[model samples]
Target chain A: MSMNDLIATIKKVLEEVDVVLGWTRSPAAGVAVPARFHTPDEADGAIFDSTCTHNLAVHLPRLKNSKVGIVAKGCDARSIVQLIVEGEVSRDRIRVIGVPCPGVIDVKRAWRCFGFGKKIEDAGGRVHMEGRSMPREEILLHKCHQCQDQEPVIMDLAAGDVKSVTPPPPPDKTGIRERFAAMSIAERREFWREQFSRCIRCYACREACPLCFCRDACSMQTREPHWTGGQVNAIESEMAQQVRTSHLAGRCTGCEECERACPVGIPLMLLLEEQNRIVEELFAYRAGMSLEDKTPLLTYDVNRDGGWR
Target chain B: MPKTEVKIIGFLCNWCSYAGADMAGTARMKQPASLRVVRLPCTGRVNPLLVLKAFREGADGVLVSGCHPGDCHYNEGNYYARRRMEVLERMLPALGIDPARFHYTWVSASEGAKWADVVNEFTRRVKQVI
Candidate 1:
């Protein structure tokens, strides 16, 4: 189904549900943000554009016990599944309208593609790409190329007809590990030092992550004998990165929101991908695959297979 | 001659290493006096983060001793502990920590003499690094 059809389906569902929560083009047409519609007229402004990158499920629990209909892409559905597994939200309380997303473009990449002097505008639900028409490949997010699962894992109500096209294959870890192995110890340190120095401490990466639910007690914001001093210096930034990466070690769903939200382009996913590789190699566990399965690090069992010891 | 002081936090499994340490003391074996032992129900209970926390809190070294792989009181506790430590060892240098500061060993209750040897070697190595 096309973008218009998906919005129309949401409009029909919202008449019965308390609210229809989904993405709409931001005032700056190049971006999309989560928005809610209580009435059909409000739904007219809803969109499913290339700029729709934010996972709508993050806002679902905040809506209280009210019945919510969310437009979930592949990543959004995984967040919904994780939330249900954690008992944060009931599956019955949510009506998932799944959309097959081909991935959204990064704003920085978009700027690079279109060059300066170009301005973006959101007209109703569509992004009017006025300034310059660059090749789609030039502006697409990197994570999209690595995405293996494009189909919604869990959906109560589907919108677009499911396509059978195979998604890009699972990332070749051997290639990644080889790249890391090739780097000299000193070069690796210098590389990370340069990447972390650009961090601005905006916390958008934390805010964008669906699994990072501990926003209230985040160590970055703590002041009592501060774990990390509240500054963007190299040491503090590196510590913050370590803390954030460790916190998401077993829980990161690999949605790539943290890397996407990073204004400095620090390649935050590299840290997470490395952790994921370690967990998989050590315990043969994968996150966000099943609600029944517990995180390997957090769960203890004496009788499992694979004799590592 | 001045003696070097090394702060070493040792996590011992209750069924084996803890008993081994006790037996070493009962046997009056001459072990290093620097080791501070914390007995846990099983080695599986020792999270790698706790070991990192000990280092971050200024311990010169950390030692995690569990039952020999198959001899865990709970049957496989030592196995899980071993895997966790193996992975953690790889990431230690990346976190700017000397990998030698974190040690993992298999000590059975019968090996009271070996427990003394483990502590002596660990304390000596820690002193050298510090």
Candidate 2:
């Protein structure tokens, strides 16, 4: 939908909720950045576009005490629904203003190609920045290219015609996915060692995750059990990520926030995506698809689950 | 330098696998000396992290044994453990650990000989991979 429709919907929702979580144009970044609009007047600046990539639902659990309104794109809605499924936020406590997502682009890639602080726009299925244009397909976030949920899974209000959004093109399998598949198990271990060694132990991936709502009790940094150490070496970093990945086994919605937030650029989604696929294949479940859905790991089938053995 | 022998960590449920392992020990069944056993209250208590921690601490392999399905001391602990273990086992290869380095199985308190077989076979498989 258009920016006017997005802002109007946020404005309408702001009347009832404590704050409307949406995006606003950032002059410094030359793209949309997440903003909280507490009043209808503030909603005038709320915008949603291809550059609006943050999943605002990450704020829901932290704001559990407040009646919040969120502007969710299709993938973000999956996270919202998954959060609801996990009972992180009560259904009535939040209002989801669903935007028919036109697929968000990788702002980092855009900034790399067009230069930073240059106004970026998406029109006619092409991204334009500094008078240069690239095909929209070239810069769409990796998650968006494989997006199966163009329609929000749940919403209290629709910002635009949900059906107007088209499906993403089939994923190109030649890059990281192919490389990962090509690597043998031994090679993968070495690959992860080298990749994780570059990690600065910033924990940005955990912070950006919408499902990692465990706040102070997160085992990633806990010393009582000492799941991972504070050392910044590859082993400790890998173990820290192992804790995060295992915790997210049946729950991660493949939002790709962790990868985006990771300053060191660890391909964290490769692990999460593989786990999500395995969970789907083994249990016939996808996290956050429905409110009534049970988490695959929390439940079991007495007579059925044996192929992994 | 060449490694001398494989080190395998075994997490055995207290009610069954642990007792079965005790039975194996009392019976003097000859099995690989590679496994170091840690007993927990139930298979459900065997968090996948413990296994990962064993691996990270330089254990060559990890094994989890519990009561047979529908026969857990806590009624359904192994049922839940089954799913978690399966997910973790499948995840090992993706994490770059050889999936064969990890295993999970059922062993009842009465099945002492069976426990010997389980340990011997698993230890053998781990030795081959290492």
The TM-scores, one per candidate, come to 0.79, 0.97
Q: Give a tens-digit lDDT track for model 2, residues A62-87.
A: 99899999989889999999998988
**lDDT tens digits by residue: candidate 1, B27-78:** 9999988999999999999877668667766898999998987788998777
Q: What is the C-alpha lDDT profile of model 2 across B37-101, one tens digit per residue?
A: 99999999989999999999999999999999999999989989999998899899889999998
Score candidate 1 by DockQ: 0.24
lDDT tens string, model 1, A248-304? Answer: 766677778888788777777777776777778777776666668676666555566
The lDDT, on a scale of 0 to 1, for candidate 2 is 0.90
Q: Worst ten-residue run, lDDT, model 2 chain A?
A: A165-174
Every model: Cα RMSD to truth: 4.9, 1.5
Of the candidates shown, which would achieve the greatest lDDT relative to the real structure?
2
